[model samples]
Target chain A: MSEFEIIRDIFAPLTATAPGAFNLVDDAALLEQQNLVVTKDLLVAGVHFLAKDPLDLVARKLIRANLSDLAAKGAKPLGYFLGCVWPKHTDRASIEQFARGLAEDQERYRIGLYGGDTTVHSTKTGPLTLSATFLGTPPKQGMIPRSGASLGDDLYVSGTIGDAGLGLAALRKEFKFTTVDKASLSSRYHLPEPRLTLGTALAGLATAAIDVSDGLIADAGHIARACGLRAEIDAVAIPRSAGAASWVAAQENRWRALATLASFGDDYEILFAAPPAMRRSITVASKASRTEVARIGTLSRGEGVLFLDEAGRPIPVEKPGFNHFT
Target chain B: MSEFEIIRDIFAPLTATAPGAFNLVDDAALLEQQNLVVTKDLLVAGVHFLAKDPLDLVARKLIRANLSDLAAKGAKPLGYFLGCVWPKHTDRASIEQFARGLAEDQERYRIGLYGGDTTVHSTKTGPLTLSATFLGTPPKQGMIPRSGASLGDDLYVSGTIGDAGLGLAALRKEFKFTTVDKASLSSRYHLPEPRLTLGTALAGLATAAIDVSDGLIADAGHIARACGLRAEIDAVAIPRSAGAASWVAAQENRWRALATLASFGDDYEILFAAPPAMRRSITVASKASRTEVARIGTLSRGEGVLFLDEAGRPIPVEKPGFNHFT
Candidate 1:
């Protein structure tokens, strides 16, 4: 059992009666009366980020994570609440930098800093922890829920996957990329671009949607578990950057490399389920947002996520997603 | 400077432009369009609770802290979003206990579990941190802000205060009680009883209000600054528990002991301002809620909080309130 399992077994049941909570399966919750979608995430230093990461980037990443959750729910940013356990040594100057980062993001994302609380943790040696609760609203159609993935729906993902995962590896010096610039890889890991445009465009077009925070198989499995269906993702069909493709080509074990890329977490791209008939709409959406969307799999009457090769043979997954304490 | 000062100097300015945020001075932010009042608080181990504290009490305190914020704003609980960073060794049993505590409070408060996120933080030796964001609405009339204390307003505080402060001291073995039971003091420190009824009643009657967190003097200073006035607190008029009074009476430095008991933090009681004309209304409200209201101070044309003795001379204040990184 992992963090996700603990949530499902112990916490998800608490949300069973709350229709908007989506059983804690979807990225965000919806308030129909308020017409607001809300999601909260806590990021701690050390476990969530490198201990010495810049405070500015730390603040930005915290907000972006919540923004990514909103994007997955097909909602545009409205406002947010922030709660922080400030490291004991944080001075006014450091706090100013953190606030500056949040200000910049609020302006960029058209969200306001609504309210929050700040406390000092005297003994915590790790990076300061921050929790952000983002409130959003769909610009147009109703929210695309994660539980409506009917059988035979085409599974599509936005942008390329595994950049962030590899980026993290690169940060730790565990992996090197000759094809991709180190800065590019690291930026992907540091800052996640929330696909708000594509998600809003998804509206009624995608029956089910989720942001890929966990690895491809793991997050996709969320839709499967929620919709009570199975998802088959083609490893070959997953879009990859030229750098990623080159890195995979350079690997001694190609399939394992591909699995590593696919299973690493923090993609932040929207994975969606829609019927083939709506492929044209998805195409238009991709074109509109100028973000690529690739058809990677299909949904059927089953459970869990299946990773298949070009010839439709099964590919074993070593790490399905970012589940803590697995 | 204190934690509140840091927030005001660093973070409050960021919120000045967002009218919905109320300059981050009020207990909660009003999302008028959403018809929601929101407040968020982060509770960290060591700072907010002991590492070995019961998970049930941890969850309860987290929710109660946010509930206190809502109560201070004269808002009744609607729902909340929770974000928690689980400690590495957190098991299913602890999580279940936490959820049970939350369930009990939700039932007691009539608020729903809207949504939230969970994550595991390994390497955290201290207690896990939790943040709760409460969404509420005014129970009646408009919100009782902190800024409306007129020059001649009478300041009133609901319930006893020093109980919680002394309770914390008792928990840390800094204080011992023979006049009161251990459970009474420990409960005061662990579980804050939010004065929702008193707050709601004061919504229209009280000119200004704030929750007594961060100690009486510190929090009272908030209303003073917000109202651009002065608060003259009569030390003798301050409410205290039998245990706290007994402890203070036994001390050689009686004034300092009294001040320490009065200024210790974690009392979620509501301190409010109303004109002398509203005394009848305050009495009625107190009777209705079955909570005692003590008139301890007065607001006048000045600034800062002043502690006065029975002879109207200043009682030198020390440890005015709780401030982190002071």
Candidate 2:
């Protein structure tokens, strides 16, 4: 079964009593009374990232992934609880390096490490597994749920959409890249910049929002399916970093290249939907937050996500997004 | 390095700005203004439990472990966030079974499920790893910190000790056991009864508190070290279940046998410190909460913990508790 099916069939019932949990469908759980948003994310080496990646970058990625959830909910992070299952024979120096990563991010995000557990795996070859639970205070207007999107809503994405995917590809040597571009792409994969400012700024403006972690088309599909609407994206309007654009230009089939980019996960950009009338307000908020925003699509009375070409032809996508189960 | 040393040397400094984190020394981190207590724990298969343990019991144990931390802080559980890294090829039925276990405990504890992450390891040989972050409301009088114990304070522990360790032993077939005893011991190891009621009841009455997870003596040592005092325990006063008592009776060296019991972790009982004057009040609280409490030790102006015999002679203990890193 897919992750969604597992969550819907098995875990959703567990949240029956928690109205704020949004039936396990939202990006983060809401504590409505306190205007608090809570989110947890797990990352295992060899699955989420290369096992040989720097411990510092691994630590930062763990924190950023959860922060992106809170960001999507328009929440200001307060602190986080961490759980680390260190591989056996893990030296104190390696742990200190991980701590240094957390320390650097704590300073960057202005959040503290509340408390957590650290245990070493019993076997020498066990992979490093990490989990983080982040708590945040939501904007005064409250959190934006992914299911809040309305039909005829215009979708906007913060920053670039496919840079992280390109970065991963570059790291894997799937394609050649300039020294600077390779470093930049690798950094994008290793460390995500959570759109906290834009998320908070769009709080009262955006009808619904979600972070692009599970690929743009897939996450946009999440909002689309959540609100019972079809997210119709103008494929040409999908923003990409220069490196990603160049990479796409080099591909034999531009449409398939674009599809691959849209289907790749790890972009921590906020994907939001708002009524067409709110476009001006979103632009103003975007500028005020100093974040780049691109109008990518519109929510229509249909189902799932649809990527259209410049000629208004619907492009076929074999896989809409990243599914861990697959 | 020991878990305590890892926390102190590597993690504590990260909590410098979060006063409520108690420098990573306390069981649960406090959110003072919200009267909230939060804790996170990670359990890995083959390390924390046998790999073949029931999924339901594993789920319950993960929740109960975090609940125990909240209980130690005199807090009433509100909800929990979970992170499950299921072993590869995990079936729908297995996950459903795990959910059922969580469902049972959620009803028993009257706590709602918050939000969390669920992922599958990429490797078939990967051990299942689970994490939980529990949040709760502290008692009206506020939390009972581990560092609150004072000199001349009497130390108390709720419920029986050593059963969990013996239960694990029985499961491993380390010794012979009656069918009834084996089942009882196995249940104790799988399902620890968190002393929540007793902990909250001791709010204003107890000076300091900690859950007996890393053995009674080690937990007592935690409170002692936190408060710059020494704990002196009467070995004979340590309470034990009938199964544990019979096992101790069968041992040739009673002193070493008793020491083994005191050093066995996973008790999940609350160990607390209180003034001698509150002895009668404690009995009232204990009875009202329907939890058995034994005054087994006292704090003095010294360091570490000392276990004494009936003649008041200190009995040497090689290892006082379970250390994950060791």
Candidate 3:
């Protein structure tokens, strides 16, 4: 699997950054003469993915996670470098399947494999750890960081929240789901749509932006702290997919369920803030990118991410996002 | 150690790719408008280094390993992205030590931590796996890959070889060594001096070049195949340190010991080939870099690599380098 004999064949062809990269025959890869965006993510098996998860899906998840960071920053994908640490049991067939996933995404995203390293650890007995260092071009409006939000800016989020978290819960048998429901929820957890076009379109308009890898409340808190503003997200205004809506509708305490759903992580949608004056521009960006953006609330001269019910009453949050330490 | 709480303190200041990186507050880092070089290397404990190895040494080795690749391509250090998967037992002190190592090396080589991701992997039971994606600017002469070796070119290698392999063997107790000997060999094994200046100097002078991460003979073979030429390495001309020299001298069968040492990977020295006409330039490069370059071989019109004894006879290679399966 991770043996050099087969991996060499798979890796060599992937190194197609010619002219500058020297087809990766050279030790390093070359970057464009522009302000390149660099981001990295570490995905550990058992933590990032299930052991039974297809290698192809795992590969896609890895690429998409890093790509999501770029999209959040209003950057365009250029290329990426991968580093994988394989366990002893990994074989050539497994590696080939993983490459197939990467190949599919590379074609879809129009990114090349600049260079990478694949190492085999014979003594490793746990889940494999994989990482990617993604490179890209900055948006015309430059980088949109979380620390740019301002007071009175309207907070908006793209796509539906809580679907991924519910999907994971269903997968773990914490809840029941129909065949169609399972597919929709699991796929949401597996394949996150990195809002590249929407993020790019919002580059000049959105004051601050972040991809919702963590839970909505938690990530909003990051933007809030960075800009020294309070993010007041109206829970009733939070968008939800049909599947998520139906799931929550079945619960007796619907608002509580909504709160629970929004608090779970893994939604790779764009959450951003923009002044009310840019509402027209924001609508234009959403229409042009064909992505929906819902106005949740506004930033105030306060601290942390605050949630409000329909009556505008503050709702206390016990947990914000995923924490490594339980 | 990998906890986001304390890690926040360590990671924020390391985002020295300022003005573009947004002080690690942004989702990504930005590069300058130059011919950028990108390379990544995965270092796994118990595989790339000893599990008991000091964290500082581990950090230096990781940075140097990636830097070595860039050096081979005639690239100067710029910045790097780090992806670290921490096992359960790691903690704040360990991460601090690791950061200190990176800080020391960042000062040693002019590079910065552009961005990085650190994740807690409680399931991982093996030695930590740390990966770095290094970015650099190529020399004005451009990148020198393995595919440019011309016929009748002189083969040159920087520093010494086999010391790493021997050092590993000595560490494994396969060979005995005194305190001075052990320190010299282990340091060579742990701390590889990337031939940055020499490689930049060799950019135009050398026809092709590669860093000796794999064994010297094996890497020479790569250039041979890339250039469609045969490499004839005079084994006796291969350089050695005083410690290695004395160890080999003490052996009953010095050639066997030499072969073993040469075949051991991890010697991050530069091995290059250039036309004899560029002797003056090569000499000037050596002088400027203050690094010794030894002519150990020649390129001939043929295929693969051939090792020659003092008598100019071909010596068979049973195992050219380290194979993961073995």
Candidate 4:
């Protein structure tokens, strides 16, 4: 099938059942309701993923990355706009698989492929780039902004952290692992499950929220800066996956490995904060969604992120979060 | 002065003044509004533009392309999401200039820069690719869908056509031009004025509307297919710029050139159809807005687009419109 055919047959079918599916063929899609929450992300082939990675996984990754942003704001996705650039020698099968993956994710998120533009290049060295814009409805109480955290609010995380980071290390073959460890690590890297349920549930309950695209400490730092409050993370409370522990145990630079795992980007887990009084209710909601909820830290009356041991001793780092420029 | 810095300093400031400008430092900006319209466009360097094109113009072109989509639906742009891919050797100055241009267009359009992603590639063979997603609001009466046209509706165009195509020809050195001709043509190529005012006014009046991106005839064909009606255009009634007649007079392939101009894309003008009863009101509205509106065709109980001479004879062409796949 041609690229257009692939998009029409696979991706198009997935969009048929979306909320605002009527105008998919138009230049833009119209939402039925008035209020909206929108976000976008760009994924470049080499920088964001290896060219040799499975095309289906790459497509899924792209969707998940954007969905994570929506989840952070406690928004339910309505539709997505896609922009794709194809390489010269891109085969029909590859495009078909990519479309199939996109279709799968669209159905999973209940989002229509509203409208987008596609272009092809003659050069082989150019990496394919996929940009997705996610549209959704903000909660009635208003979205949980990164800047809404309050001093003395409890820090919480939905789902285990560092799996995606460790998964990346395993993918690069920089670390060796057993069969189960390999499967767990690879799954983390290839299929990041955004905490959409937790995000939507925490809309009114959480004081502040952000998806852990960067490492836990770094993402928390974003909340701190935005809220004009210092965040203190109890390092001992960070939840690590089964494989992550094994990987760290085998490392001579255990502390460094743990820190890297804590700082590595691509974990789609939601890290949020709320009043200490609301912690029990937040945990109940998280459990109802079948996602783990842990109190990892607290917001303080200061700036930046402060990491502490169980005894509340400060842990120093060069920086708290990932800087794209650096 | 890195790419991120340019985004933070230049583009961020322009978007700051608009509503829903959230944490630019986050993975995505959260937009809170009712009724969102989302559209995206991808522009590849060599494919959509020349490598040596001014950075400012490139940025403006990217924004205009997206804004034009919103204009077609009578949607007021709320914000934009940009996805940029730069070459490895690209310096901060070029990116900063591009950001400045982006800021200029954002302020002009009264839209914010919500969020986007950026990446750098190693190959010089790959042209820079910029993708923009525009979030907008539908008019109170709702968006004018391309499929809403009815039989016996009068077809209208907001502005003169074919300037951009001619501008492109001038840019490729395929045509020689006088200083005035060069300025006019280059302006058309570099900056497309989207008919936002006309589109907004057309919300309740026009049966259906679409932006004339793929030439008048081809775009008319889209309306015909969507609304299940035949659209017939009177070639003699179609408005043209002063340079159009001169260029046609100078060309040996006058008929071909005229046909080419009629099928040229990037006009960013609105093409709509309305009942005879709304004709007088539409004219009044057009006059009030100071946007030119010409009645160039009529919709009939048939399918496809028919181009006719003054005597009603059909004008034949090998291709009706430009296809992205083709």
**Judged by TM-score, which candidate is best?**
3
What lDDT would each prediction earn against the true structure? 0.76, 0.81, 0.84, 0.80
Candidates 1 and 3 compared by lDDT, better number? 3
Q: B1-326 in candidate 4: lDDT tens per residue? A: 34446666766676675556663755555554467777778888876777889999999988888888888898898878888888767787888899888878887988777777776764566578899888788999888888887789999998888888888888888888887987897788889998888888888999888888878888898888788989999886777888877887887865566677789888888989999999899998798778999999999988888888767888886676665454
Error of 3 at B199 (Å): 1.7
| Residue-level error in angstroms, candidate 3, position B106 | 0.4
Descending-TM-score candidate ranking? 3, 4, 2, 1
* Candidate 2 ranges with C-alpha deviation above 4 Å: A1-34, B1-34
Interface RMSD values, listed in order for every candidate: 12.9, 12.9, 2.2, 2.7
- lDDT tens per residue, model 4, A1-326: 34345556555676675646453557787666556677778787766777888999999999998888888888887777788898866767877789889878887887777777776774666688788877777777777788777789999987788888777778888778888998898888889998888888898899888889767988887788778899888877888888888877888865566566778778889999999899788978898788888898899888988877657877676554555444
Model 4, docking class: medium
Off by over 4 Å in 3: A1-8, A15-19, B1-4, B124-126
**DockQ metric for all predictions:** 0.20, 0.19, 0.64, 0.50
Model 2, chain B only, scores a TM-score of 0.89
> Can you tell me the DockQ of model 2?
0.19
Candidate 2 iRMS, in Å? 12.9
Q: Identify the leading candidate in terms of DockQ.
A: 3
Q: How many times do residue backbones clash in model 2?
A: 0
lDDT of 4 at B177: 84
**For residues A152-222, what per-residue lDDT tens digits would candidate 2 score against the true structure?**
99999998878888888888898899888888888999999998999899998888888998899988877
Compared with the true structure, what per-residue lDDT tens digits does model 1 show for residues A1-326? 23234334433443333454444432223343465667777788876777677777888888888888778768888777677777776666676677667766766887765556667776746347889888877656766777778999999999999988878887888877764456787888888888888888888899988888878888888789778899999898888977678778889987788888889888889999999999898999999988899999999888998899878888899878776644
Shift of residue A68 alpha carbon in model 1, Å: 0.9
Residues A1-326 of candidate 3: C-alpha lDDT, one tens digit per residue? 32445545786676564345566566677776777878998888877777788999999999998898888889999878888887776877888899999988988988888877777776748467899988888887787877887789999999999998988888898888888988899899888888899988988888898888879998898789789989999998999998898899899987788788779888999999999999999999999999999999899998987788888887877777887645
